[model samples]
Target: MALTETPLLFEFEVVSSEDLTFIPMCVRFNLDRFGLRISLAQWQLLPYEDRRLLARFPVDDDTEIEPNFDHALFEMLRTHANVEPEWFAPEEAPAWRNVSAVPGGVANQAGLADLRTPDIEDWAQLAPFQRYVLAKLARKPEANHDFVPAMREFGLAVPRNAAR
Candidate 1:
């Protein structure tokens, strides 16, 4: 996982459900980078403070500490939730990190939504979390109402009225 700046929560994801009920995308992105899989059940088991700690942990490439966020997160999960961590080694560069081209699935989803597909330049310029959010949103059409709003938030798309 590349170390780039990312917000803990995107404006598009500030809905009521996301604050505590839903796992925020930034935490999920860090978990992905760490090769950890945390179920929603396990998340609900963790106290709010633990969840806040996980949200604030640093995974940026420039951090000086060794074995920083992941180890601490694992321990926290075990201590607070009594849950074992599960791992799925992510690709060295996941789809979101690839700036060469937008993933076909994302492009297809954009087309389906009547929105512009972000070009290579746009993708290349996005913060890592923004790309991660887009990739996640594209995976299931049923949960993808946020796709257009997210794209607009990322400045990759404009509202139809504004485009006229």
Candidate 2:
């Protein structure tokens, strides 16, 4: 029998004025109809220990249903945090020229020394956004372990830098 992998659902909260004010424009538009505004400084005043409690509130599944502002307010007293801005950017983006050319394709300057064809092909197959992310990760000195495994899983042949 095969075990199914469950998608991880992160329980997030908007628990402070800072979190409320800092929410991205997209989420802010959704929250505005309920007349909610979160301020960052207000959130800083709360004790850190109580912050996680905000996740106890379950998210509603209805796309059309508005968020419960009163509940949102209560949660804010202890729970909101901002998502990293970088997560929203395209993966293979910040469009720039490739650093070098291998037999079949080009590599970004960051990936020049350790060229791997299968890896290049695998990366090429991804959406430009995803390619951007892999390229960025590959170039990071601290990401060597994680990057190699990800490359192998994507069916890419290891580059010469594998031993490094």
Candidate 3:
């Protein structure tokens, strides 16, 4: 028999389900970043304190979450923010090569020295997967302490009075 090509691998379709509505940490992060600008009328439509709380999330160095949104959160976001229903592209993502290594340059900043552990230059040589892992870890709301530290290490913004 002649050799045959490998299979195309499993195929699947992703559909939204009624049981859950989800947004990833990174998307949440970006939404909170440039999403809150609004006329007072639109702002008033938001649940009291919910808009305030949403403003802080997925962004380190802001006040911690002190309120939660209703199940209508996704709908609220669409109405309040001037973004398309499904996609939002704020800025070009960090270039792959530029993002290749850990942002080793941040080592010299205050409180940013911890990422330099084991060896000072070690971070600059991390593999792409390592960088990717760090990137995902960098976006989690619960992991803001870790993320902001990395952000500072990368010369990215750290929230005001972030030392807390």
lDDT of 3 by residue, 1-164 (tens): 11114211111101211111223232244343343233444544555444434433333212134222222345675666543333344334432124433433232332342333213244456443334324454433343334444444444444444452
Clashing pairs in 1: none
Best lDDT goes to which candidate?
A: 1
User: Tens-digit lDDT track for model 1 on 1-164?
Assistant: 32234336667877933456677776776777777888898888887766766666554523244346677777888898777779887767668878888987778778877777787988989987788889978876553777887888988884333453
Tens digits of lDDT, candidate 2, 1-164: 11114211111212222233333222332233334454545544444433222222222323245344335545555454442111122223133123222222224322543645444345446543233334544454443433444444444545756652
Q: Estimated TM-score per prediction?
A: 0.81, 0.31, 0.26
The runs of at least 3 residues in candidate 1 whose Cα sits more than 4 Å from the true structure, single-residue gaps closed, are 1-7, 16-18, 59-66, 141-143, 159-164
Which of the two candidates, 1 or 3, achieves a greater lDDT against the reference? 1
In model 2, where is the ten-residue run with the lowest total lDDT?
1-10
C-alpha-based local distance difference test score of model 1: 0.73
C-alpha positional error of residue 17 in candidate 2 after TM-score superposition, expressed in Å: 29
Q: Rank the candidates by TM-score, best first.
A: 1, 2, 3
Q: What is the C-alpha lDDT of each candidate?
A: 0.73, 0.36, 0.36
Model 1 quality (TM-score): 0.81
